[model samples]
Target: MSSSDLAAVVVTVCVVVALVALIAVLTQAFALMREFRRKLEDFDSKVGPALSQLADTAEMAQAEIGRLRDLLNIAQKVAGLAESAGAATARVAATPVDKVRSAISVLRGAQTGGTGQRGKAEEEGRETGSGGESTAAGSESRGR
Candidate 1:
């Protein structure tokens, strides 16, 4: 063959080889893009429901927290009422005890036939003489 025709043939073969390589690279890029699209679709299908469920769970948790807060408020009110009731009960109970003590002192004065001073003096005498014995024993020994 002529030198010019041989050079042309060589250039044409190189161009064809470069085109084939380019086509191969483009085909691989297209396949990679399709694979990436499929993976993105799969991720959306799986994660979409999970995100929705997470939102629902958060809402439920908030509701439960609100319920708990309400319960705590009710418990605080109940505790306050209980404390008030206990204080009232203590006052009511103490009044009766004080009244009974006063009545006993009055009865002791009547028994002594004077003010309650004689009764107290007599009790002190009994305590000093009886060596820690009960008041009932000392009264029995004294014959009332």
Candidate 2:
């Protein structure tokens, strides 16, 4: 064939091939768009409710935390009151015991012929005796 005719045939083949490639590219693009639309629909159906539920749970958690804070404040106040009550009770208990000890000291003084030295000596001896007994017991246990 002539060179001009051969050139025309080559141009036609090239145009047809280019058209096929463009059609393939357009078909793939349309398919990808459809797939994206379907995924968006699924996300709306599933994740939308889940997000709303998560928001509700978050709100409830915040409310619960606020309630716990109030409860903690009340507990702290109660603990302070309990500590003060314990201190008051200790003072009250110590007062009577102190009075009894003073009365005992006075009685001991009378019994010991009003000699403060004798009363103090006797009290010391009693404390030493008790301490000695405990020490002896501890030694015996250790020996065993």
Candidate 3:
């Protein structure tokens, strides 16, 4: 063949080889992209429900925390009221009952005979003897 024709043939063959290589590389890249997209879809299908369930559980926990916070507030209010009431009771109880109880005990002691009734007859006899002396003196004067 002529040198010019041989050169043209070599150029055409080079262009054809480059085109085949480009096609092959593009096909491999397309396959890799397709596989990546398929794995992404599969992950979405498999993991989406679990992520949704996790969100639901978090919401439930938040609601429960709010309820517990409300309960704590109520308990704190009750505790405060009880503390005030207890303080008022302590103040009111600190006085007169003790005085009245001591007074009552003193009165009872007098009634029960301070030394347990041992001096009752002696004390009574002293009062009766003094009266009897006056009467006897008056009777002797009247009789004379």
Q: Which has the greatest lDDT?
A: 1
Put down candidate 3 lDDT per residue, 1-144, tens digits, no spaces. 999999999999999999999999999999999999999999999899999999999999999999999999999999999999999998899778888999999977775664344244445555778645555544454444
Weakest lDDT window of 10 consecutive positions for candidate 2:
135-144
Pairs with backbone N, CA or C atoms under 3 Å apart (clashes), candidate 1: none
Which residue pairs does candidate 3 place in steric collision? none
Q: What does candidate 2's lDDT look like per residue over 1-144, in tens digits?
A: 999999999999999999999999999999999999999999899999999999999999999999999999999999999999999999999999999999999976675563445445546766878556555544454444
TM-scores, each model vs. reference: 0.59, 0.72, 0.60
Question: Residue 97 CA error for candidate 1 (Å)?
Answer: 1.8
How do the residues 91-140 of candidate 1 rate in per-residue lDDT, one tens digit apiece? Answer: 99999999999999997767666434545666886778963454565465
Q: Could you arrange the candidates by TM-score from highest to lowest?
A: 2, 3, 1
All candidates' lDDT scores? 0.86, 0.84, 0.82
Clash tally for model 2: 0
- Ranked by lDDT, top first: 1, 2, 3
Model 2 alpha-carbon drift over 4 Å, by segment? 114-144
